[model samples]
Target: MEGDNIEKNRWACRHVLPLYASLGMADEVERIWKVCEYDPRLEECTAAIEAWGKLKKIEEAEAVFDKLEKKLRSPSVKLYSILLKVYAQHKMLAKGKDLVIRMAESGCAIGPLTWDALVKLYIDAGEVEKADSILQRAAEKKSGKPMFSSYVALMDQYAKRGDIHNAEKMFHRMRQVGYASRFRQYESLIQAYINAKAPAYGFRERMKADNLFPNKSMSAQLDQVNAFKKTALSDLLD
Candidate 1:
């Protein structure tokens, strides 16, 4: 064991804490904390905050954050987001929103991940418009490059609400953005049609038109379906 105190603390923070935290070994973290100094002024604070988050030690998280704020004028966006996620995990939506406000006041721009967590909170609370607004803001802040996930969530919500028009609109808008289309989005659109009591034939046709179908077998299936449509359903059976 090296007698260097700073190196030992750094090693423990960088390596030991994360490992123990992943394994849910809070006792090991505490053992290391007792033997070595825990520096609140550096990135090492992340390990402790994350460890506390894993353990649901909200008070401990607050203590580390207070120390970090006292030592360094403001915590990093990453730190704020990490703690916010922890609060969200605990269903502390009020506290999580409060922290986002505080993080903004501290001059850290709310990034996509931070907005995603807050959007999740709004969605879970049945605040669709609120979540939609947050996602719009997230899109605006990210230079009009909305995360694919944002569209997926909105489509899911619209489908659940049976708002087929809006769901289709979102799908089209995502394509207009020139983002590479994903099969999941196509599947969601089809499901939305089904939810709205609309025939999904148009969507299946569009999926083929967009070249978004998954495999060659789907093409064969589509051919057979199209041929069957040319013949009356009763005639095909006869």
Candidate 2:
């Protein structure tokens, strides 16, 4: 074999390093990134950084981020969002929160994913009050539509704590946003009453007055209601 052709590493690194990094081949990623950094293309560097973040390799991701041209890295909103997502998933709450403040200060439009990450971080940190406050701001803030998951997530925390009053309050807030369906209130409202070991007749009557049809998903709640009813009857029998 007397071939004398050589393939340049630039093209291969630009196109394939991200894939290798994503597939968890850290060594190959480092090798390719070393060559690719000489050219400093935004697309390639972004891919490499994203791959590192996807793999949860914080140091590697940071290295790629640093290797990006200063201008290429400075105003990149997508890159910030990606990094914030990784930060949230990895429990790097402080960094994620700092990035959020920075994004807001820089006027980089915060999207739903970033907001979701912040809320999740608060919830996971046992700062349910903060999470609720964020949901409140989301509802009241003119910047973006309130995320339904935010509402449900806060309601979940309240329900878990057997907080019927706040859970009902959240139900009212959800209704104010036109999420007044009977189904939406089951986990958010009825479950609170059930967990609190309190009768839900008032809520049932309210639903009846609202003319909520008994959808199929209501069957289990109906069964729960009947079970509670039998317990009451048995108590009176005693």
Candidate 3:
């Protein structure tokens, strides 16, 4: 009977924790975690850590991570990725770097999730070059492509810098990886052209091909691009 009760508690931890966490009920999550013999499975621990992360409770999340680490033989890459995401969310660059080193020292297989988290950490730290370098390395590896959001993050940064060349590169590379272009991606690319003071010629047609209609803000930006093109033409004629 004791064993059965323990099993039931474990099951509850797995299912109930994330639901409560998502609803921002951290107290209930903590209570449920404590009831699970403190031997919760990876999913439960992940949920608890994510819950604490959402609440900006870094130490609490770290405590959960430390506890989870003690129960596993080989360190779990997914667990490390989750914690790294928390660090990224809070812009804790130093702690995130240390965690990456720890993952390497522990011989954790760096997978897609880990790569995505690392990229996000660098991006959030305003280290776009480092993030791009990591993204390139991930692409060169056999593990997998970095997540779609990683590509978009770099694209957004490049757009901000008026880096049309690299922004377009990221956009094309994103498509080369078989990820379909979305409205946000197009927005980033168009913003790059706008920032660079270049006309996004035929972009409307391109959007038509992709079946995307611009929102009001994008329409205004496109008008600005057209005005720039006309001004450039006037300069050439002068």
- Models ranked on TM-score: 3, 1, 2
Candidate 3 global TM-score: 0.83
lDDT of 2 by residue, 51-89 (tens): 777677887776766565255535466666666666766
| Cα deviation of 163, candidate 1, in Å | 4.5
Residues 1-238, candidate 1: write the lDDT tens digits. Answer: 3235635444545456667778888897666544433454355676777777788788877777777777778777778877777786677778888998898899987776677677766776677788788776666664346567767887888877767788888788777656666777766665565456544455466776878764665454445445545554557689
Deviation in Å, model 1, residue 41 alpha carbon: 6.6
Query: Which candidate should be chosen as best, given lDDT against the real structure?
Result: 3
lDDT of 3 by residue, 1-238 (tens): 1244644546666667667777888787777778753566788788888888887889988988888787885669999999999999999999999999989888998878998999999999999999999998898888877899889989999999999999999988888877898898999999899899988889889898999999999899999899889989999999
Ranked candidates (lDDT, high to low) = 3, 2, 1
Per-residue lDDT value at 201 in model 2: 68
- Candidate 2 — which residues are off by over 4 angstroms? 1-55, 61-79, 111-113, 180-185, 202-218, 229-238
Q: Please identify model 1 stretches exceeding 4 Å from their true place.
A: 1-22, 32-37, 41-43, 141-146, 159-163, 176-178, 191-198, 215-238
Worst window of 10 by summed lDDT in candidate 3: 1-10
